[model samples]
Target: MESATLTRPPAGSPAPSGPTARLHVERWPLIGLVLLCAATVFGFFYYPTYPNYDSLYSMLWGRELLHGQPLSFEAYRAPTQHPLAIVFGAVLSLLGQDGDRVLIAITFVSFIVLVAGLYRLASRAFTPAVGLIAAGLLCTRFDFPFLAARGYIDIPFLAMVVWAAALEQEQRRRGTPVFALLALAALMRPEAWLIIGLYFLWCAYPASWSQRITYAAWTAAGPVIWALTDLAVTGDPMFSLTHTSGLAEELGRAKGLSAVPSSTIDFLVRLDKAPVAIIGILGFALAAYLVPRRIWMPTALFLIGLGTFVMVGVAGLSVIQRYLLVPSLMVMVFAAVALGGFTMLEAGRLRTVWAAVAILTVLGGVYYTTTRVNLHVFENELRFRGDSRNALEDLLDNPKVRAGISCGPVSVPNHKQIADVRWLLDLPKSQVIARTDETQVERARRGGVAIYAANRAVLMRTVLIDGMKDPIMTQPLPGFRFVAASDGYGAYVRC
Candidate 1:
């Protein structure tokens, strides 16, 4: 059918032709849907590398769960723990162990579902075919697709949110399924609580009276269940508070100041990595401008989702582009509706516009992913290593080592300091050093931190400003070591 592109075509314009001319014809997304799924898989699983440090954090939570560290709480409040990603990791552990491979597989699978969910979400607003079109655009974006490549929670959470939204579009007979999904969403990440909670309230206020009440109750159940479970297991209402608190303090991020100019610029830089980000953004703006007042209510759903992310996001302790995860999900849905309403000429035109966006986004994203290789990212969760994991293995197997374990920071989640503690324990530190303060280093390694990890710049800054002393000894790590040392990550052994 010709798309409903322009709100008001010219008065004498031939009442649109081709697809729009054939109004009696119905549109379905059978083949388009299959292609959509494949496209997402192709786009997301570009790299089969190791889980980033954040992924390792979830792995660690499973370990803690194995060691009786309740689900609601952990000794270390790493970012990867609270969400449903932890539960998935724990379940993976239950099914005999294949650490890296299994975890990577989970990440890959999540992306496929993510594509399918977007398709379904789009199907609701326009023809099912238009939903497929939206998925095609989304999979093409570099920033949105990578979450799929590594099975990180951001993509999974986005998938769940999309599904929840799609389900919201349908008429429901019960609150059970609704509550269950919200719980699943919350299980993915604590931030989801805000999104789903708001979703529930909206469902109740001004909707069908009884239905609204039911939806609100369903939505409320997620946090309530989480709270009860936390109390039962960890004696805390909000789990991961301690670690999360420390992380926020370390980063010096304000409560709701997500609109920082530098950080916003950083996001624009990240967006520049892919044409898809830019493409989809333009498509969204154009589509929104085209929408007639008649479709305002339907469009309202997408706009609300977009507002939720834009309003609450942009300021999380995450990489600038990754923040695009939430906003991307919201906009993609709107884009589908926006794309669906196009006139055939407009649809074809949008197709061209979005195609360019997809291609650009993918190329840029891939280039960034392949080049610029460093394991020092303090915010990204998916950590890849060339020799680091192996070097760590060799050190842990040494006979001379006694109670040797290294500790260092990669990223902070749950206000928790440091990265990859899960990897730290499973992989053990031979002798660790941190570039942080004496206080932080001491707390992280109360068991006796021997060797230290620091960049030359970190040392100079601490020495120049803080007036702190030196490490008893210093060593190098990976590409460039800070100073002369015995082993990687500055393995300091007790004499």
Candidate 2:
């Protein structure tokens, strides 16, 4: 097959107008259908059973809204609990079907949106052909399928960032819709806050003082609104922010900020299949040396995201590989641009070599997805969730336990770490009242709460070892009987 490239009009010619002209001039993402078909086929055979932990946390928020319960901000504010994803999960529940399938469907849709977003951004920055190739190459990377097979917010959040970039590139203006997409992304994850902040700074250079101020204000709005909402309910304006900060401080104090450099290097080695990571590195190199100056905006944005991820690690949060998606995306775009050739390789011999390489890279991705990662992700998720569900159900089925149990007190780290509270309590939100101090546990015994459940591990730690204190302040309280235990959880009912 011949290699494809965009056709630009001759110099001094007037820009073409109309939809027909646009179609002929721009490259469409023909590779998107391939991605769709692959995802659809994989989902049919290996739909995920276990929701990722953050995803389950978000679903609890959705469940809360569904039941018209108020969200408790003073409780551990799940960093993963974005309003949009919670809403998305709530909407998914309305189907009243098997939750596993609904979650699978969410992953499938997130894949499509991600591919489409990448294509749009590539098309705007380089060429439609480049965009198509970039999206195709992304589909082939080993980690992509494993991720696409689960309903992780990482992919959805990246999709929003890429799509916003596409719109900004195409419009050449800070339009309202673009800002809206960005705001949605920021609300979904704090990582996007880095991207949003960089954008505001970028605006300061070329934009008028008034325009910069307007964009800056818009950029600040999402976080401000989220903070205010937390304040309204929790009576503390900084509840969510402080929760995240406190976690970081604990982690930083224990692990030290030195962990950041190792985490960033680990990202380079493991974010994708080795070959794709190599290609991404090569793409970054080529973008700097060969691609047009116009591509610098995305390069800068990628660096900003990377720096932000490192700073997060410095704060003591574990930097997982998926956290690198924003930078990975820019690398893919750069790789696509590199593969397409800056000025389009001459026809015949060079074009033939280019086409061959593109086909092979894509085929490598297909083999990895079908033969390895898909089955791995599917089976592991099913096994993990099966055990988790068994533990949760064992607790829920005990006859003596009348109402849902408090997960325990708000201040304890283990309270947030307890496994499957969402499934155990059968409640809408993850926050059950906490019985942290002796007073709360006593209150629960005195008609305050009917039962309290904890992950077997969390229960052992809180009750036996730590006595629910930061430094083991007191002995375990009496009057609670163990009702049941399972592979992954334990329950106690007030006697």
Candidate 3:
């Protein structure tokens, strides 16, 4: 496709007019967005939480780097490290115990950036009204906020990619700024490698040789740095790919190519929900019919996102919902267009009827959300994440538990708590063992401090409910005397 400038209404369509149009066209759009993001941050400030499992490992590895220690990427069930995340982790690790919460704060900022990027892209491609609707839809999707709150690297990765796309939409062949953002995104997720590569080709033909070389260098940085990092630490350039695949298989998360079709549909429905999914399809069709050029980028993004998801499954990596985030986001944009793109039409009966349809669709969505959405479930989950982490910290900080750690390794019920315990205590891998490992069962039995769930909720979520089928793993080791207890966790030492 030829590079095109920012989208304008098709041919002779009249420019937006009247009060509604004036409201959308003014400076208030950006001001309103700023206020919304500010409110969101302030509202959630009190509920500061730690990183998710993968992100915690990033901080741990970063701490190792900061202290001149080799990264333990080869540790059992270790997540693949992203270059930029590790760098941020190394910087944040300087904060010591407060690093985790700071990382989460950065994630919240990234989420805001993502929402703004979505608005900019959609608005530039269509109108400010569509942009506002897109932003609203994204905020309403609880999963996006939930991911941001949990400090998932995916949030930042999405932010970079969305902003890159928005910049490109603002001015086609945007060059370095666009490539720079995607390069940063590529450091966070390998999926961006594909995006940046395709973008390089798209812009290459119109560029001089030097520009192509620069873009190529930008394209190679993410994977090359990742490989070198892996090779330096694990002595295998392919360690991340192989290790992640093996881990996925072990965890029963890798679904093969045969399941891609079903998984794609299922994940999209889950992300966008059924009502928005149906509306997105209609909107996508309407946009395609009305102005194909306007939606080319979104259309390409939707396809590329799906293509990468398929590539992931084919490569034996874990096939999860987050992989489809790009496409789901496009669905939100297109759905916004269906609901508000009519505003771009010249005043007429057709515009009036379409506007009425949009209003009813929104009302129906509101009704569906009101009846089906339960705020308490989201509240409970967020509450548990904060509560559980605090409880684990309290248990680990207890003097008795600290004294017991000197006896031998610290053992948890399974791999779920490995990073948490290790990070909390700043202990080496050998110093922490998961009782679920058959080899470690005897070691755990021999001597060490073992942590356990303090209550039914914690037990069901942590110890008893793991991928391991071994019932014996959850049983208390013989001779372990209770040492310390906290609201969500308990500790015992066999020494």
Candidate 4:
């Protein structure tokens, strides 16, 4: 692609000077491939680099697929989550692979593929040189890589988001390639729609107003097409969306906006421990700076796509920046430009300074990655893992307590675990509890429960779990046996 500037590069046009430029451009891909590979290997080899909560659930759903179970719109509660993820999970299970390993691998590969897609898309801009710079910076972004290597939908959604942008102008013949991939992704995670919408903008930008409306209709056709197929198979065209939207706000109003700043600090400060994120951000910034002027239309379109997305923060994600991952990844493209050394900067002194900044950003990213150990590998070292999985199993140790409820092969005790304990225990309840959490004990005290239990660790966990404890009543149950185990969680057994 030729530069759109009045002056060519050598005349202080901010373009590369000297014979090495083209050669460097040609070699951009190699660097992208190497950096991506390095980040991926590091992420997977370490302690899965994924939290054991939602990350683990996606893996479990995938295991279900491997077991020949049909994807029930109701079975895996997050109706909007991509079904493709579960399909991927099932395949891993069939191959007898560990769900975590497979999910992490898929995440890593998808990220690399997203970078390649960006490289292809960027080819229309800077020489391979600038594209490689973009790839490298993106490779080290503060948040993208960390989430990119998990079984979660954000990374894959991000890849598709870029892909849509690349095809912005290409006709359907070259656009929408076997949207089964998109459908599956959309099914597993509803947020993939953000990518779809962004890609649609890139695709429809060049059309006439009438044609733009047509393009809008056409872009939505992918989901419509899937809905029709779903209807044909399941007799409910909108079952997934209908089923999912209902559950979106199930958690209700969460703790609120305080989580945003805390998460931002986590994302940025984390750069010290995982430099790959910074590398990615800087490389993307460089690409933004170097993208050919003609390519600005598409890049601008990418930004619009991203902006609209975050504004639509879903019911479950309103309070946290982590939920902003979808939009964050999208904007990172422009951010790369920002890091690439400011597109608005004129050639000469400021440009030189911007270049210095970009170089420093990239250098800082590298230093962060090299020095940051994958400390999560030793996450198990800490107690109160924040994981609810197997928590019920571990806590209900008494034979009589375990015997009261029957689950698995034998009947789990008749007692059903209450709200907030769903993930760590069986759901849909074998038997209803009088209440859950705070209300639970109150009801148990009023009526008659053989045993009253509460996690004492809830009070002591002031340092670890956020919102760990709500409150224990000032009044005590007459015969309650309060047991505060050293595990940082307490158990109360009522006689």
Taking all chains together, the TM-score of candidate 2 against the true structure is 0.71
Q: Candidate 1 residues 158-247, lDDT tens each?
A: 667667655654433324465567668777666567766766665555578787776666666666766665666667776554455555
lDDT of 4 by residue, 348-400 (tens): 77667877877786677567556764545434422233332235435545454
Per-candidate TM-scores read 0.64, 0.71, 0.95, 0.59
Q: What tens-digit string does per-residue lDDT give for candidate 2 at 1-495?
A: 122342432212333689887666553444456646776677545533545656766665566668777764334435534667777767765654356457766676777788888877776666567777778766756466556565677777778888888777666566567777888888787787777877776667888878777788779877877777667656776666567666555434323367667766677556555566676677667545544444755776678778877777666555566667777777777778666644344456756876787667667766865775566654665555445555555655665443424433211224443324443455433334334434344443443122233454434533344334432122223554565555555455443
- What residue runs in model 1 are displaced by over 4 Å at the alpha carbon? 1-48, 69-77, 80-83, 95-97, 170-179, 205-217, 228-246, 253-255, 258-324, 333-387, 398-492
Model 2, backbone clash pairs (residues 3+ apart or across chains), number? 4
User: If both were scored by TM-score, which would come out higher, candidate 1 or candidate 4?
Assistant: 1
lDDT of each: 0.49, 0.60, 0.86, 0.47
Error of 1 at 138 (Å): 2.3
Ranking by TM-score: 3, 2, 1, 4
lDDT of 2 at 423: 39
